[model samples]
Target: MTNVLSFEWKKEDYVTISGMIDESSDFSELFKKNHEVLFLDLKNIHRINSSGVRKWVLALDKLKDVEIHYINCSFSVVDQLSMVPEFLNKKCFVESFDARYVCENCNTSQTVTLVVGFDIQAGEKNYTDGPERLCPNCKQKMEFDHNPDSYLFFLSNLSNKKKTAI
Candidate 1:
């Protein structure tokens, strides 16, 4: 039962959020203010849920002009969001890479198939961890999958790997 906490902005044009953005968040009010860029500063945010994601999507649609960006998101948040295609597709922002491959050109999501509970490893090993290779669909080199606790670090932000363009 953690309570949601955040700051209210009126004219900063950049909204930074901390704390949990759960059901208690004031999404409606935040959307009404009309910010040009919404920086959901999840730097200190510990977690999020279905309700929170719904609110974010709804607010995103409302704030069509607002360029949304997420910061300091935890691996759990990244994995959860990747699991939800609707939410993943809506976010046109680049992630810090804790287990998602965002196409540089199309911005499409390419998540690794979770090999837990089904494909048990012969020993203590994470199945998600595989050699890095180019995605067959996009032909762009995708980052290797990581353990849930490990954070995926990106070497570069500028990636639009298309064979035609190369």
Candidate 2:
């Protein structure tokens, strides 16, 4: 069975989405005529299927005029963002997201939160360096679990779009 997606409004401009995004997911309520800015928190999203991706892209297209700030994106959300070009638009900006890190010594894995323009710069083709993450179990530093290039592919795609528009 697919997990039900839920939406909660923390503020007039901020909203949180949790659970799974599938064919049944409905984002109609988020489509507003006068909503100028929106902060979308996707930290708790665990899974997304192809149908969900279609729905998400359509929803984003509707909000093309609104400035969207995506925050607390989970690994699943990040994966989709990297793979799907239509997952994000010119008006959409990623404020923060999580990256998987693993400790070589203890083999303990953890998700590190990275802020855009601070921890990592968007629109850069290469992202070799990231903020140092210390392992909880061991004192040694942890290494990023995924390849920076593939994980940050969306940033490069966004950058290309900006360049072509200029």
Candidate 3:
């Protein structure tokens, strides 16, 4: 588990969370008592455990009325979104997240940023079928690291929220 200092509050309206989200994370203080919208920045988060998932669910339960917008969600966060059905809640929305890719030749992995309503086009959830990226380390074609159907399952819920017409 990473240190509790991974959570940071800013402007009394937004919270930026980094590092691994484990039992050590203090999500209680991160949620404000009075706020219409809370922008959560998960850009730097890399991991979340079962305990962290439980804590995350409980924390969101407390903010039922608050509109939470998730921004810069890493691959770990994406996994949570897929596994934990209530993790995102109805009031929450994902703005952008990271998609993983790897080079078979070099075994190099990279994360590509994908916006909820942009990079993930409607009726085209499989990134593997999309454009191929050049591996930064090996200069070879990089493949999607995880199964598209499983990795992008969370997007199904968001597809109707801010979807861009194709």
Index of the highest-TM-score prediction? 2
lDDT of 3 by residue, 46-89 (tens): 78899889888988988888888888888789899988898888
> TM-scores of the models, in the given order?
0.50, 0.88, 0.78
Tens-place lDDT per residue, model 1, 44-85, is 555777787776667667766765555445555555554654
Each model's lDDT comes to 0.48, 0.83, 0.76
Where is the poorest 10-residue window by lDDT in model 1?
157-166
Candidate 3 scores a C-alpha RMSD against the true structure in Å of 3.9
Candidate 1 root-mean-square deviation in Å: 13.6
Model 2 scores what on Cα lDDT? 0.83
Q: Lowest lDDT 10-mer window, candidate 3?
A: 157-166
Please give the clash total of every predicted structure, in order.
0, 0, 0
Ranked candidates, highest TM-score first: 2, 3, 1
Misplaced by over 4 Å in model 2 are: 159-166
Model 2 lDDT per residue over 1-166, tens place: 2388888899888899988998999998798546888889999999999999999999999899988888999988999999998999888888889998999899899988897766876777677755688999887999988887788777666542221110
